[model samples]
Target: MYTVNQLGKMYNLSRSTLLYYDKIGLLKPSARSEANYRLYSKNDLKRMEKIATYREAGLSLESIADILNSDDTNSTTILEQRLHSLNSEISELRKQQQLVVELLGKDSLVRTAKIMNKEQWVNILRSSGMDEDDMHRWHREFERDLPEVHQDFLESLGCSPEEVSSIRKWSQ
Candidate 1:
């Protein structure tokens, strides 16, 4: 058996977070002391381990609670949803990273990337009579020559992450 403090320290969780979990009916103590202090049994400790594991895997507290408490759980769906969300986030971050790399590549051997709004780029493209096909080829050629500048140029035009990714894909 363990007190809340003991269990929290063992699991690297704060007392308040554990308390919140309990309050939310996420992880109830298996027993109580005579003084009504929360007493977690061995089973509760194991449950906490699972909770921590899921959290580290990027599962939300609510989702963890559902997994722990719900009948169906639907763990496969939960995990798949989390996986897809992570992939989308990673894709966006990659676009931003490519932009930064190109910007730095052009300016200097610096390590940071900055951004501009999208409309500024569109106006410049309009002035240049840049169409989709031309823009597509531009990305390919720019990437072929300068390596990273293609994404940066697109970003300078104020393109969204998805737009940048789409342009890169089509250019390929």
Candidate 2:
């Protein structure tokens, strides 16, 4: 048998956290000392480890409890869902990173357009086949004056200067 403090130390949990688990009936001490100290058994420790694993995988305490109690809950199904969500999050982050890399590569073009005070970004957007109405809506909502910023963003997509100029003229 392990005392509350010993169990807490082993699991890297606070004494209060273990007490809270006890109060919630998630974990019950196997025995109590004559002095009324909480004593956990080996089986309780193993259950705590399972709780920690589920918590690490983003399951809420309530959800973990449900899974533990339910006869129909399948561990494989839960794992597959968590894996899918993590993969989707990773894919989104990768796309954002690629966009940032493309923007950084057009640093020189960005600098030149900023100096010109011309809407080079509008040209860039037009070159990229981005809708004029969408650009107008974006400009109105964002109140951003730097067309060169958009130009740099578009140039990052590998558009030619001629194409960008044509789009800029068409937009006007």
Candidate 3:
């Protein structure tokens, strides 16, 4: 048997984290000591090991609990869903990296990448006879109609997260 602190130390998790897991019904102590302190058994340790592995795979505590309380088929489906999300995030990061490389004037591999900087985008808008008010109206319409697409367009233009946030806020 292991005390809560000992188990936490062995798993590299905080005592509060373990307690929270218990509170959330994700993990419960297998036994209690004479002092009424939480005591985990070998089976508990095995469960904790599975929790750690699932967490390392980026599964949420809720998802980990669901996976643990279910069969192998359910766990596989959850893992596959997480994999899809991770792949999409990786693709977005790659686009952002390419934009950053283009911004830095690194004329090696990313020079031919079709990325439009802020200045070029603004210039194109101005050339198209879109004054400041016209652009604002356009943004408003875009935000009202397709907020997610607007966000993606802003990100593709290499806007900083802060800039994108500000634009979204005002567009609302």
Candidate 4:
């Protein structure tokens, strides 16, 4: 049997986190000492390891508890559902990554256009019918407010606000 501290060190988890797991009845130790210290066996360690694995795979504690406690639920069905969810998440992230790559390419084009002579720039803008004053106003407004607006846009896109804002500014 291992003490709580020993178990925590072995698993690289904090004592409080283990205690919280115990309090929630997620992984109750198999035994206790006369001095009231928690004692865990090999079986307990195996259970904790399984819990950690499920958590890393994005299963919530509540869901994990249900899976562990449910007698009628088939483990194979639960695993298949989790696999489907992970695959869907991966697909969505790949789509977002493709959008980022396209945006970066557009930013490169914009930068190349900016480096052109004034007349060339003006002609390009004229061909596009993009007004100079409007462009300037837009640039200034984006400079001042884009961090927040981009944050909102990214949140809508299911990306981290900070990460999306950084990517948006990277194009500028």
Candidate 5:
């Protein structure tokens, strides 16, 4: 059996955190010492390990408790919901970032906060089944149909001014 302090140290958790787990009925000590201190058996260690894993996956304490207590829990549903929620948050954050860059009126700031580069753009196109010839044709069409937007798009990919100029010249 391990004392509360020993278990906390083993799991890199604070004493209060373990106590909170106990309070929430998520993990109870399997035994008590002679002096009434908490004593965790190996089974408790395994339960704590599962709790740690679920926490790492961004589960709330209540959700963790439900999952631990229910023998028929649908963990995949919970995980998928979390994934969708995270995607929405990321999209909102990207919009906020764009607004900040625009508000500052600093194109250089956009470069500093660059989310993608020319290499990444090229890789994405390649992954989407675009060959070199297909990419050139697409760029030519973009330059012909929406020159200004095309320029901004290239700049957004973190291209230098000189590189953007060369690409536009070739796209013609």
Candidate 6:
């Protein structure tokens, strides 16, 4: 048996997180010491490992709970959904990587990635057949992924406050 702190350390989780899991009925200690400290058994550790795996796969707490509660958990559908989501994300990242590579090839060793100003980025998007909606999605993804960098990039483009506000609002 292990204390709650020791169990959390084994899983690289915080004490409060374990307490929250216990409170939510997602995980419970095998026993308690005379002082009322939580004690985890090997079975609890195995369950915690499964919980961590599901969480890392992006399953919601409620979904994880349902799966744990169900005797015949139909996980194939959920796994397929997650796989599809991951594939789409991979495809998007690949497109971004290709765009970066193409941009880099536009100049010699002296010019850096910073040279692609706002107008150039917009032009590139347009030339790549990115319509208004596609451009908006791209900007929204950019802002969502890196808000500070997006702001700095817009500023580097020398866009006015009104322009920046308009662009951000439209992209959103």
For model 1, the superposed segments whose C-alpha errors exceed 4 Å read: 71-73, 110-172
Tell me, by TM-score, which candidate is best. Answer: 5
Across residues 40-108, which tens digit of lDDT does each residue of candidate 6 receive? 999999999989999998888887887777755456666677777876675465446546655667564
What lDDT score belongs to each candidate, Candidate 1 first? 0.78, 0.70, 0.88, 0.71, 0.84, 0.78
CA RMSD of all predictions = 9.8, 13.5, 11.4, 14.7, 9.4, 11.8
- Which candidate leads the pack in lDDT? 3
- Deviation (Å) of 81 in candidate 5: 1.6
Residue-wise lDDT of candidate 4 within 1-172, one digit each (tens)?
A: 9989999998889999899989999989899999988999999999888888888888878877877777545655677788888766865765575465456775454443312323454477678877877655554566567655544434444455466556466535
Which candidate, 4 or 5, would have the higher lDDT against the true structure? 5
Superposition error at 160 for model 5 (Å): 24
Task: Write down the TM-score of every candidate.
Answer: 0.62, 0.53, 0.62, 0.57, 0.65, 0.56
Query: Residue 156 in model 6: shift from native, Å?
Result: 30
List model 3 lDDT by residue over 86-160, tens digit each.
867965985777657866775567656667667889999999999999999999999999997788788877788
Give the Å shift of residue 149 in candidate 6: 34
Error of 5 at 101 (Å): 2.6
lDDT of 1 by residue, 46-146 (tens): 89999999999999998887777666548777888998898668657756766666666766854344444455565677689998777667768877786
Q: Which stretches in model 3 have alpha-carbon errors above 4 Å?
A: 107-172
Greater lDDT among 1 and 5 belongs to 5
lDDT of 5 by residue, 20-56 (tens): 9989899999999889999999999999999999899
Model 6 TM-score (2 dp): 0.56
> Weakest 10 consecutive residues, lDDT, candidate 3?
102-111
- Model 1 whole-model lDDT (C-alpha atoms): 0.78
Location of the lowest summed lDDT over 10 successive residues in candidate 5: 90-99
TM-score between model 5 and native? 0.65
